[model samples]
Target: MRSALLTSGTVALLFVLNALFTGSLVSGFAMPPYILQVLCLAGINIILAVSLNLINGFTGQFSIGHAGFMAIGAYASAYVTVAWGDRFRAATSFLPEFARDGVLLLFALAVGALLAAIAGFFVGVPSLRLRGDYLAIVTLGFGEIIRVFILNIDVVGGARGYSGIPKLANFFWIYLFAAITVVVVSRTVKSSFGRTLIAIREDEIAAEAMGVDTTRSKVISFVLSSAMAGIGGGLFGHYLMYLHTNSFTFIKSIEIIIMIVIGGLGSITGSVLGAILFIALTEGLREFSQYRMVLFSLLLIVIMIVRPQGILGHLEFRHFFGRRRRLAAPTPPVIP
Candidate 1:
C-alpha cells in the first residue's frame, strides 16, 4: 500500500509537471503550442536515442536506419486514420457516444507502431548478421529502400505527401508515452537482459563464449527501438497533419544518431537531456539559420575532440538523480 501510494504520488507529480510545461503559464512568451511540439519531438527522440543506445551503446551493433522505421509507422498510421476517419464519420454522422473524438487518431498511432515493429523485425533479421560499418551501410540501404517505397506508394499520397490528419497529439499523450518510454527502458536496462546487452557491447566474443545469444539480443533491441521511432514518427505526422517522404530521410536518421551520440550513447537520461538541448540549440541558432548546421557540426567536432567517448557516456540515473550513499561515519572518531 505504501508503494502504491508512492507510485500514485509520482504519477500525480508528473501530471502536474506536464500540465505546467504544456499549459499556458506566462503571457509574454507567445511561444504557442509549438513548444509542446518540441517537447513531444524531444520525447520521441529520447526514445529513439535510448533504444538505439541499447544496440549501439549497450549491444555494440551499428544499425542506422531508425528513420526508415519511423516512416513506416507514420505512413501506416496515416493510411488507417485517413481511411477510417472517412468511413466512421460518414457512416455515423458523428463520433459515437462510446468513442472519444480522438479514438481513431489514437488507434491509428498504435497501428503505425505495430506496422513499424513488423518492419523492424524484418530489417533486424537481415542486418543483425552485419556489424560495425557494414551494418551501418546495410541499415542506410534499408532506410533508402523505405523512402523509395513510400515515394512510389500512391495510397499515402506518394511524394506529394499526405495531409488532413487530425492533430490529436497533445502534451498529455506525448508526455505519457515519454514517461512510459523512460520507465520501460530504465527497467529493461536494469534487468539481466540489459546486463547481457552491455556484456555484448563490452565484448561480443566473450558474451558469446558465456552463452549469451548476441544475435537475438541485437534483433530484439533493434525492433523495440524501431517501434519507438515509428511511434514518434506517427506523433510527428499527426502533429503536422501532413507528412512527406522527405521528412524521414537519411538526414533525419543522422540527426537522431547525433542526439544519441551527443547525449552519451548508453545513457537514457542523457538522451532526454540531449534531445531537449538539441532542439533548443537548433531553434536558438535561428539567428544564423543558414549556418546552423555548420555551427552544430563545429560544436560536435569540438566535443569529439575534447571527449570522444561522448558527453555523459554510460552515466546511470543514480549519478544524476539518486541520493548519495554516505560513507560509514569514521566510527565517530572513537568518542567513547
Candidate 2:
C-alpha cells in the first residue's frame, strides 16, 4: 500500500508538472515547452537505446537495424490510424464520444508495436547466425531495405510521406511508457534471464556449452527491444503529425547507438542519463547548426579518450544507495 501510494503521488506530481509545461507557465531562452518535448524525446530514446543495448551491449549481438523496426512501426501505425481511426470512432459513438477520438490512435500504437515485434523475430532468426561487423552490416542493410520499401509503398504516401496522423502523444503517455520501459528493463536485468544474457555477452561459446539457449535468448532480447523502439516510433509519428521515410534512416539509428555507447553500454541508468544529455546537447547546439554534428563528434571523441567505458558503465542505483547506507551507519567506538 505504501508503494502504491508513493507511485500514485509521483504520477500526480508528473501530471502537474506536465500541465505547467504544456500551459507555457515556464519560459526562457529555450522555449520551455520545447524542453518538455526534449524530455519526451529523451524518454523515448532512452527506451530505444536501453533496449538496443540489451541486444548489442549485454548480449553482444552486433545488430544495427533498430531503425528498421522504427520504420515498420511508424508507417504501420500511421496507416492504421489515418485509415480506420475515424471509422472506429464513428462505430463507437455510444461510449462518451470524446473517448473515441483518441482511442483509435492508441490502438494504432499497439498495432505498431506488435508489427515491429514480429519484424524483430523475423530479422533475429535469420541474422542471429552472423556476429560482429558482419551482423552490423546485415542490420544496417535491413534498415536501408525498410526505407526503400516505405518509399515504394503508395498506401503510406510513399516518397511524399504520411500526414494527418492524430496528435495522440503528450507528456502523460510518453512518461507513462517511459516509466514502464525503465521498470521493465531494470527488473529484467536483475533477473536470472538477464544473468544468462550477460553470460552470453561474456562468452557465447561457453554459454552454449553450459546448455544456455543463446540463440533463443538473443532473439527474445531483440524482439523486446524492437517492440519498444516501435513504440517510440509511433510516439514520434503522432507527435509530429507527419512522418517520412527520412525519419527512420541510418543516421537516426547511429544517433541512438551513440546514446547507448556514450551513456555506458549495458547500463539502463546510463542509457537514461545518456539520452537526457544527448538530447539536451543536440537541442542546445541547434543554434550552431552546421557545427552541431562536428561538436557532437568531438564530444564523443573526448569521452572515448577520457572514459572509454561510457559514463556509468554498468553501475546501477544500488551502488550509490548502498554506499550511502554504509556511510550513514554509526561507526563503532575506536579501540583505545
Candidate 3:
C-alpha cells in the first residue's frame, strides 16, 4: 500500500511538473513547438516499445508484426474521430464542452484498443504456437496483410492516406497514457501471470513441466501488447491528424523492435529510455538526409556486437536507487 501510494504520487507530481514545464498552466512561456512535438512523439514511442516488450521481452515471443495492431488502432480511432467526431460530441453535449470532447476522444481510444485486441486474439491463436524465426515470419506476414488490405480500402483513403482527423491527442493525453502504460505493464510484469511469462521465456519446456500454461501466457501477452499498441496508435493518428498505409509497414515494426532491443529486453525503464533516445536519434540524424538509414544500421550493428543484452539489460529504475543487494551468507554456521 505504501509503495502504491508512492507510485501514484510520483506520477501525479510528474504530470504537474510536465504541465508547468510546457506552460500549460501559465500559457505565456512554453517549450518550443518542435521540442513539444518531439516530446509527444517520444511519449507515443514509449507506449509502442513497452507494449512490444510485453510480447518480445517478457514473454520471449519474437513478434515482428506489432505495427499491424498499431495500424488497426490508428485507423479505428481515426475513423471514429474523422467520420463520427461531431456525432460523438453532439451525443455528449449535455456535459460541459471541455468534458464532452474529452469523452469523445477517450471513447475513440477505447474502441481502437478493442479492435486491436480482437486482431491480436486471432493472430495469437496461430502465431503463439510457433517459435523463433517462424513466429517472426508469421507476425511479419500479418503486418503485411494488414498494410495491403488498408492500401486497397478506399474508405480510409486507400493508398493516398488519411487526413483531416480531429486533433484530439495533445501532450497531456500522450504523457498520461504513456505513464499508464508503464505503470500497468510494470505491475502486471511483477504479478503472478507475468512470472509465468518469464518462466516461458527462460525455458518453454521447463516452464511447461512446472505446470505453466505457456500457450495461454503467450496469447495473453499478445492481447495485452496489442491493446496498448492500439491505444498508442490512436494517440499517434490523432496527434498528427493524418496517417498513411505505408506508415505502418514492416519497417515501422522493425523500428519498434529496435527500440526495445537497444533499450534492453524485459526492462520497463529501458523501454522508456529506448523510446526517447530512438526518436531523438532518428530526428537528430535528419541532417544526413539520404545516408541516415545506412548510418543508423551501422550504429546498431556496433551496439549489438558490443552490448548484446541492450543498454539496460533487465535493470529497472528502482535498481539504480541504492537498493541493497543481499549477499549470500557463509555456510560456516551450518557446519557449526
Candidate 4:
C-alpha cells in the first residue's frame, strides 16, 4: 500500500512538473523546445539502459541486440497508430481530447511491446542456451536480421521508411513510463526471482546444480527487457512520427551497452545516471562537430581507465550513502 501511494505521488508530481515545463499550468513560461526534446530523449534512453541492464547487467546474459527489440516495437506501434488510431480516437470520443489521445497511445504502445516480447521469447528460447561470446554473436545476428527483415518489408515503407505515425508521446507520458521502468526493475532486483537471476549471473553452473532453472530465468529477463525496449521504441516512433531501420542498427545497440558499462553493471541507479550523462555528453559535444566522435571516444577511454568498474560499480545510490554512513559511525569501545 505504501509503495502504491508513493508511486502515485511520484507520478502526480511528474505530471505537474511536465505541465509546468510545457507551459500548460503557467502563462508565458515554458522550457526551451530543444532542451525539452533532449529531456524526452533522455527519458527514452533511461528505459533502454535500465532494461538492457536487467538482461546484461543483472542476469549476465551478454545480449546486445536490444536495438532489434526496439525496432520491432517502433514499427509495430507505428503501424497500429497509422492504421487504427483514428478509429480508436473516435470510439473514445466521449473522453476529453487529452484522455482519448492517452488511451490511443496506450493501446498502440501495448501492441508494440507485446510483439517485441514475443520476438524476445522466440530469440531467447533458442539463443539463450549459448553463453558469453556465442550468445553475443547470436543476438548480434538477430538484431541485424531484424533490421534487414524490416528493410525488405514494403508494408512498413521498406527502404522509404515508415511515416505518418501520430505524435502522442510527450514529456509526461515519456517520463511516467521511464519512472515505471525504473521502479519495476528495482523491485524485480529485490525480489526472490531477481535473486535467482543474480545467482545465475554469479555462477551459472553452481546455480544449475542448486536446482535453479538458469536458462528459464535468463529467458524471462530477456523477454522483460525486450518489452521495455519496445516501449522505448514505441515512444521514439510516435514522438518523431517516423521509423527507419537505420536508427536501430548495431551502433545503437553498442551505445546502449556503453551506457550500462559506464554506469556500472548490475546497478539500476547507475543505469539511470549513465543514460542521463551519456545523453548530456552527446548533446554537449555537438559544438565540436568534426571532432565530436574523437572527443567522445577519448572521454570514454579516460573514464574506463580511471574507473573500470564504472561510476557506481554494482552499487545503488542508497547503498553508496549507507556505506559512507557506516564508515563515519563512531567505533565501538574495546573491552580490553
* Best-matching candidate per lDDT: 4
lDDT of 1 by residue, 194-266 (tens): 8888888888899999999988988888888778777778877877789999988899888888887888888
Per-residue lDDT of candidate 3, residues 210-258 (tens digit): 9988998899889999999999999999999999988899999999998
Off by over 4 Å in 4: 321-336
Tell me model 3's lDDT, rounded to 2 decimals. 0.91
Q: Report the alpha-carbon TM-score of model 4 versus the true structure.
A: 0.94
TM-score of 3: 0.92
Cα TM-score per model: 0.87, 0.90, 0.92, 0.94
The lDDT ranking, best first, is: 4, 3, 2, 1
**CA lDDT of 243 in candidate 2?**
89
Worst 10 residues of 1 by lDDT: 22-31
Model 1 stretches with alpha carbons more than 4 Å out: 1-31, 86-99, 324-336
Question: Model 1 misses residue 220 by how many Å?
Answer: 0.9
RMSD of each: 5.3, 5.2, 3.2, 4.2
Runs off by more than 4 Å, candidate 3: 1-24, 322-336
Candidate 3, residue 319: Cα displacement in angstroms equals 0.8
Please report, in order, the local distance difference test score of every candidate based on alpha carbons: 0.79, 0.84, 0.91, 0.93
| Least accurate 10 contiguous residues by lDDT in model 2 | 24-33
- Highest TM-score against the true fold, candidate: 4
Candidates, ranked, TM-score: 4, 3, 2, 1
lDDT head-to-head 2 vs 4, winner: 4
